[model samples]
Target: MAMNRIADTTNAVEVHGVVKHYGETKALDGVDLAVPQGTVMGVLGPNGAGKTTLVRVLSTLIRPDAGSAFVAGYDVLRQPRQLRRVIGLTGQYASVDEALSGRENLYMIGRLLDLSRRAARLRADELLERFSLTEAAGRAAKGYSGGMRRRLDLAASMIGAPRVLYLDEPTTGLDPRTRNEVWDEVQRMVGDGTTVLLTTQYMEEAENLAESVTVIDRGRVIAGGSIAELKAKVGGRTLHVRPVVVAELPSMAQALDEYGVHGATADQAAGLLSVPIADDGQLTSVVRALGAGGFGIAHMDTHLPSLDEVFLAVTGQRAGGTDPTDPTDPADPTDPAGTKIEEFAA
Candidate 1:
């Protein structure tokens, strides 16, 4: 079978000069975005970067103070009802009714979307199997594990067969294994012709699932492009070396510096030393120099610049400290009540 096309410019999501403010705070500072149909666009940023706020505006849960947006050709401001018809949103936390069985939760959402009783049951059953929740379909969601709950949450979002899905930090708090599982599901959805706009703090997640990324910082878009393009903005590939013994760390660091590869650091916790290089040509010189210096290398890998480095370089902060679920402007651009309102809007 021919592979489904990921995105088409003829039909897509579009945002223009979008801005939202609360008193003195500008939650979304003239943000603009475009997501081609059937493709995944990863929104990357730190806390208070307005990622969730932008999601809310696109999902139609909150209106922007200025500018306009469209989903599947329907205006977000004037045609919210029509836009909602083609859109599904799954937030950071599972929104399934805990007291209800997994099947019941899916059925309920189907009903709300106007599916008949028989159709609702059939849809629920189909999702139960697809999400690997068939065995637990009859169980209350409250008793389900984190991964299962997340799957069910995604299943619920699909009940209406939405063409566009907004996953705002959907895997936030999931263990690495579970996170990978969610990523797999997202890939499957995109393969099946669903357009996904994912907001995430996990650089790995964005790298794995997103065809394009837009970096937001301080409520404004600092950068936007394909993953390779964004990585290029951060410079060339990174040369990572892991010595066999901790005692070799100092020598490895010095060797990296000798090659003019600065910012070399030893992560004792990971037992690895890494440095950024200007190009792939530096790799051979690095290996030869390390070997000549008598530094025994247990493992070495050269990788392109990751989104984590892009985040740090663009935002001037690390990823772990930024929480998209609860964004607060440490700069205090807005008043207490205004911040609360913006938080709720998110």
Candidate 2:
């Protein structure tokens, strides 16, 4: 492997031609990604697509077989010790100790990161209040709700005020309200100049939080861009029309096809006709044609291709499942967080 590519100084995280393997398995085959400073880059893929392996490499939990990666102005391979200090990682499962109190967990992490006892205590108290855990700060983590433990784990990651945070499925099984709370915290971190790389199975979460997204499948990137850019790249807006009379569906399809509109499809079960529209002008033309044909519309709307649809079209698979190579499993000895504090202090 050769380091012929120049680093992108503006990016808080940059990876190029990264490859990793397990026995004969090519978990990551030449994956490339970049996340600009102070923004979120969503990594999406089906199970076993190497999403977690890439995270482990970037976080310095494991080394890549080839290529290069730089985070927070430090090379992941050459500057791993320095890199560890400026980065925080939270995996799919909450890694906080259940026997410890919420406040104690944060304080312990702070202390391990080399904060003075007084400083660690102050930082713990600050985070407990910031994450709205002050009321339950003294309670053992085992007794806390799922959402509470999640917030505490997140708070632990921020104890060192990292410059880059890696959140790998941070909101996996939480309810909607708790998920939104986690989203809010991520936004706040980015607002304060911390870069974030998020990997998740939820399309809505990516749409709401990611400034840009990169889709990977089978250890390679299939698509990469902002939500709008990816949607446009996949296909243009689709016009959905539901006629008031179920019997008129056939007529409506014929009318649309006759109006020079191509690829119009009818779903008999939903009683709706969908066609891809090239532009707003075309949408208007279709509406006028429908009106002139005496077709009464019950509902009509147009929207760009959704992330979920884009993912399926590009990867030929749905967005979520278990990634066998992912070390988020508690039993996996290579779990990134296993020695998080020690690595940070080193």
Candidate 3:
């Protein structure tokens, strides 16, 4: 394990008024993003939200119709080669060659990056062990589980030890447990002084991994801030109290209403009444007021707004609501090669 270091003062990535268009659709409508060295910035949005377009522009795979971008302080348009040298990108699906062994796939990537044959093999071994794929290194990637394949794809991206990494929904089809494992690896990567730009539908992943978040909706940035900051934009802490008996629900609602607090909608279906509190003092008052009403509280919980709530409030749709596996949706357009599927097309 490597000790985390402070990022260099130089910004690893900066995008100023970037715009990309596909026919009549605007994939990136004057989107701006800045990523400091050795930090993580999570780009969060639903399908067709232009997350992939932004990643493609930043990674040098696609050109923007307008606006300029810089990676490692090099202009993306004029110095694409330089930008490519310092950045790595892993897309939604695993990009490893299934016919190749895990070690072979990594070694090939290392070699492609101009590492010496021996050096490539050594790097492959190191990464295989680090990603816990050493035991299966010699097995064909097709035989590896989805988690292993995803890890191998990530290891391949690190062949050149990039200073900035772009992970665009790297855990799309992964199970919950596998997703956590990938999350831990990402934390380790950022801790090792690598600046990461992540686009994920998982709100919890954003909360866990991102130092800051940029929320996009309909090809535009609707909000950008730290997790807590974004949450505050939607609302304050929620005071939830569940009475022991269903008959007491009305009393609880009345008590909450007295403080100008509105109950959660019938959609929540928590069998509890909730009110938004402005601060900890309000929380204290709510508790005191509830106690005075002689309401036997079966449970009480105060919750800050989650990223899910923030996404809903900002986008008018829930995160992870769209079926990622749907083929007909233009949000996921397959390339002619069928090897690189654009998972979030606008």
Candidate 4:
């Protein structure tokens, strides 16, 4: 796992004008975000966008150079000692003790959190059962599978029943099935009223769990909203058409622009012009306008914007190429045929 992944999380964590710098590099620059309670707040950005840095600040591992942050009502900088009590952190790698049994590890964490010996034992057992690690509770961490260790780590995080949880790319390398298991555990956490903050570059992961997202680039916010809202900026549903006659290009482009279409892109080489429309009705409007102009339409298609488009439009980075850890992430949109997308209009 990279850090940790939150599943169907609910609630908010806020950062206001948060800034951090390393030497001459500004890792975070006047970044502001609001995540409502009971909702997954996915922070999407490329490498060096200060995602991990922001996570470190919010988790109280490092103090910010400017601005303030709050997690579940505690100030991240001024009250880190108090903040740590209400938040749980599960990084990419499991933080459990490899020399001890899972039961011992969880119990130790509970004890460190100030639980009585008997209470710690009970809490450890309960968490083991909660995460389906009961059967392996007595086994040393080194003997556990990748998934088991992660579950143990998550259980340790919950020792204090934190109000807010920070999951930093929780499933980077796990198999699909194991990842799903971890996701299930996160869902249960939100069900009990824990707010979650997640930082991930995985588009599918964000789509599956986040209700809204804040995308950053170069330590600044590039976009922030629900997936639909972000896509809307890049033309939620785009209409692409080509005129069989080259002479119709200007007329088509003009008519579409006159009709109030926003940001129409043209590829004259292919005799193609594309514009983002509000919906199918606008597609009808374009077709009507073109017909009124006597332009013969060769072909037209309408499609929803992909997340890759959103990333590219805002960050100037392809989703695949940005993650330095694995540049060949197949989830990118640079494939020969583009992403396999559903045609909204034909």
Candidate 5:
């Protein structure tokens, strides 16, 4: 992870008012994204949020009906051929040939990128080792585990040593441990000076991988900022109380307010009361006040608002994923087919 390996580009990827449509469905409604050099920018939204569509447009697979985009300073439309040379794309699914060995897959990709036979083989070996697939490089990818296959697929994308990489839900099907491994690779890639545009529907994934996030919903950006800033929109520390007697909820809310707790809400059905407490001092005061008000506590806990809650608060929907079946679609499989070929190694 040497910093010198990094190729410097101030804004690796930039887009302005990108617009696209599928029949009557507007997949991207004037979307704008900016990814700085050697950093990770996450695109977060549910299934039909135009995340995939934007990735496609930026990667040169799909042209925006309106607006313009650039990758590695090359125009996505006018200089797409040149842009392809400096950018790599790994779709939602691992597109490596299952019948080929991990080494073979990467070698083939290198060759396709127009690397000489020896150069392709050497690059393939390096990628295999870097992604920890050297031992199993000879084995058919079909035999590899989910995580290993994903690693190989990612390595294939790196065969050309792309300066800007687009990863669409890179860990979609992997377990938590495997996903962490993929995240580690991404971290390493960026540390070495690669600019990454990562698209994911998972809130935790966005929080873990992104230096900044652009949130899109139904093909439009509703929010864009750092994770902390987005979370702040939902307010701060929250204290939850389960009263021994549900009837005392209102009295406890009043008591908590007297103790400087803000926005106390009660749920009679669940016999629970929630208060937004500024700090531990406010929490302590609220608890003391509850005791003084003759309210016994069944249970209590303090927690900051979660990403799902933030999504719900902003978009009025859960963050499970954008349901592909929705009227508005980004793309199928996060990889729109393209004929822009990478020349095979001579």
Candidate 6:
């Protein structure tokens, strides 16, 4: 593997005051970001919020109008060739050739990265096994499942053993099961020390994989922090108190209010009293109130705000909408006519 070529640096990626404009439309507006080495940093936003634009800039696929970026300790502008050597990118769609066998797809990328014929074959074999494609190594990718194709594409990106990876909404259009499979592969790579920048709108995906996240909107970063921290910032926990019988819900709500637990609402259908609490102290009060009132507690759960809730709180809208595509963010450069792969080899 060529991963040993990676530079020793505290942060695998750093961007400062990056600005990219597509004519009059500002795609990125003075965005700054940092990803600590060997961690997964999730870049989240609604559609057309510059998630892909940022990834393109970091991967050297497109240059920002102003500001600078460095990936794997190589300047994105002055040392793009060196940076490309240590980074891999998998875009929204699978980039594998449908005509090629799974093994051929990986081998071709290995060869494109300048591996010798024997070395390319060995690397292809290793990745196929690692990604669980060994059983279908000889089958054409055209017949592969969506999950299989995604895995193959991920394997191709790893052929050069890149020290950093950029995944731009890699789980888009994937089923839950398929997305979980991709998440597993990504986790495995991170376990071996590859820093990853993942751009996605799926809250569950980011919550599962990212150690920290940067939330962007309208071409700017609105918030950035650990999941728990962000959740705490957005809202407090919801205390759900389910009673043993439906008739007890009204009494439960009344008792909670009498005990100084304000904003308690009863759901008659589910027979639960929902209270929004700021901290654990309120939870103890609620427990004591229910016990003192002789309420039979069927279940109780305290749920921190979900990522979707956090997204809405930060952006003032949901994490996804039908936003028109920005002209500058072209289709994956891995197209047959593009030079992305060849540049990596160079």
- Tell me the deviation in Å of residue 166 in model 5: 0.8
How accurate locally, in lDDT, is each candidate? 0.81, 0.82, 0.80, 0.77, 0.81, 0.83
C-alpha-based local distance difference test score of model 3: 0.80
Q: Cα miss at 137, model 5 (Å)?
A: 1.5
Give candidate 2 misplaced runs (Cα > 4 Å). 1-8, 236-264, 269-308, 315-346
Residue-level lDDT of model 2, residues 54-83, one tens digit each, is: 899999989999999998778899988888
RMSD of each: 7.6, 10.0, 8.8, 10.8, 9.7, 9.9
- For all predicted structures, in order, the TM-scores are 0.79, 0.75, 0.77, 0.68, 0.75, 0.75
How well does candidate 3 match the true structure in TM-score terms? 0.77
Error of model 3, residue 168, in angstroms? 0.6
lDDT of 1 at 255: 80
Looking at model 3, which ten-residue stretch has the lowest summed lDDT?
332-341
lDDT (Cα, 0-100) at 273 in candidate 6: 83
**Which regions of candidate 3 are displaced past 4 Å?**
1-9, 236-248, 255-272, 275-308, 312-346
Give candidate 4's root-mean-square deviation (CA, Å).
10.8
Q: Candidate 6, residues 17-78: lDDT per residue as tens digits?
A: 99999998778988999999999999977677789999999999898999998887788999
Residue 71 lDDT, candidate 6, scale 0-100:
85
- Please write out the lDDT profile of model 4 over residues 119-214, one tens digit for every residue: 999999999999999888888999999988888989999998987888888877789899889888888888898878888766666666677888
